[model samples]
Target: MSQTTARSAPSKSDIAVVPPRRPSPWRDRLSRLDVKASPYLYIAPFFLVFGVVGLFPLLYTGYVSLFDWELGDDNPVFIGFDNYVELFGDDQFYKTLTNTVSIFLLSSGPQIVIAVLLAALLNARLRMPTAWRVGVLLPYAASLVAIGIIFANLFGPNYGLVNSVFELLGLDRVDWQANRFASHIAIAIMVNWRWTGYNALIILAAMKAIPREIYEAAWVDGASPMRRFFSITLPLLRPTLIFVVVTSTIGGLQIFTEPKLFDAMPGSNNGGSTNQFQTVTLYMYQTAFEGQHFGYASATAWVLFLVILVIASLNFLLTRRLVR
Candidate 1:
């Protein structure tokens, strides 16, 4: 080998050197800012508010129900389910439960049915449609206190339009607030008047959302309007119906204003002359505030809550079945 050739040849240590890689921008950003922590940070306010407002009051109510607490009392004594036991044994509780369920059935059932029918009508082509819809919703937007006062005047035994009409027709005047059935009917009418339009509008929206093509197909198959409504429209509207029924049930179960106002007359505040119009919620109010039995009232509230839960569950199950 020549000396020049040996000098041109590379040694073993003469190798190309590579620089180390820097981290990606995205990776660096992600490392600095965690997505998991960000989500929790965003959701923490809702949880905090719910804990303070919703959960704390519910838990406190339950705790209070276990003790013998009274309004304007200095000390509360622990009773350990005695409030519940006493409630079950009480006649007034049973009466209130019956009244609540009865009013719920009478008011909610008819209201939903009428509302669905009205919604179906409203969804059809009609003149001045916007005006009609706005008029329907007016009742719902009206003040409940105002509604109660209005109904009270209309159903009053004396100097009321209803009794005046009866007298003009030579029919006997009905004592609306004094009679059990009459009082219930009056309350139901008020409830129906207030909520029917709201529910109808909701169902109308649902009915409108249904694809027109389905109705066209039904018509092409020679289905009549009535047949189409029963077979196609109702089936498709089951979800909306379920929603209205469940909500109406909740509202009816918690009926307060109408009965309270009706009973505000002289010799009438215990829900009527005979407690005939008193609902569970009204009963709770009377017990808690008027009667000053806080523990018992808390027990009543819990019972009412359970009833609502059961009804809601049943409604959901039925809805699922109907959908299937």
Candidate 2:
């Protein structure tokens, strides 16, 4: 073999050719910035709108409350917390708050009881199940204005359905709207009528989520229906019950339209004579619109908001502790 030929054949294997890298489909389809930001973009509109409509008004209202502001003022007088001071000292404020609490207690007890009982009954297999469910929700579906009007007529001082029933039963016809307790009871009855079925539906949904096996085991152990309910159902339903409680308290505290419209006496907007049935919202409206005390009304509103917040927080804590 010649030296030149041996040298030329001395090289090992040749290097293989490499293909250029391909970009990922996802990366190609969307920009890196867009991929990272899509989730935030999707949820931004709700918060943006809320900030515009809800948060701005809330903050502006608080600012307004710090001044002796009213409609048609040349310049709002900056009075730091004086409106709030007056609000706290005012006797009518306390009266309205007291009335609100009275009605809440009176209504909430019967409302919860009726809701639980009805939920339990509806949980059972019935002949006309769909019809029963529909019937239960009918009152809730009715317009609030209509409900108020109908209930007002039903509890009228004279010729009311409730009084007529009492007359038939050889009982004295009690004045519903005249007496303090009676007025509370009438308002409570209306609240329960409008709300019981709605609460029942929530409870029923919770009940249905309970495992059938647990009930079966209890039944095999000779637990009565009521026993199983107390032992198995109620214990399992604590979370849902807490949710219902918080929501109900919040809603009950904010009740405005029902009482406003339900007063049988024409053109009565101050809740009742001497503010017997007045809620905080009603008082605030009356103060702002009727009395034209804008700053004071705004202060009243802030105080009411704080009160509701504190109460709801305490309720949540207490109930959570009880459960644990």
Q: What CA RMSD would you report for each candidate?
A: 5.9, 5.6
- Best TM-score among the predictions, by candidate number: 2
- Compared to the true structure, candidate 1 yields what TM-score? 0.87
lDDT of 2: 0.84
Candidate 2: residue 48 Cα off by (Å):
1.8
Clashing pairs in 2: none
Instruction: Provide backbone clash counts, one per model.
Output: 0, 0
**CA lDDT of 216 in candidate 2?**
100
What tens-digit string does per-residue lDDT give for candidate 2 at 187-258?
A: 888888889999999999999999999999999999999899888988787887788778888888877876
Candidate models: Cα lDDT each = 0.85, 0.84
Model 2 alpha-carbon miss at residue 101, Å: 0.8
TM-score of 2: 0.88
Where does model 1 exceed 4 Å of error?
1-34, 264-269, 319-324
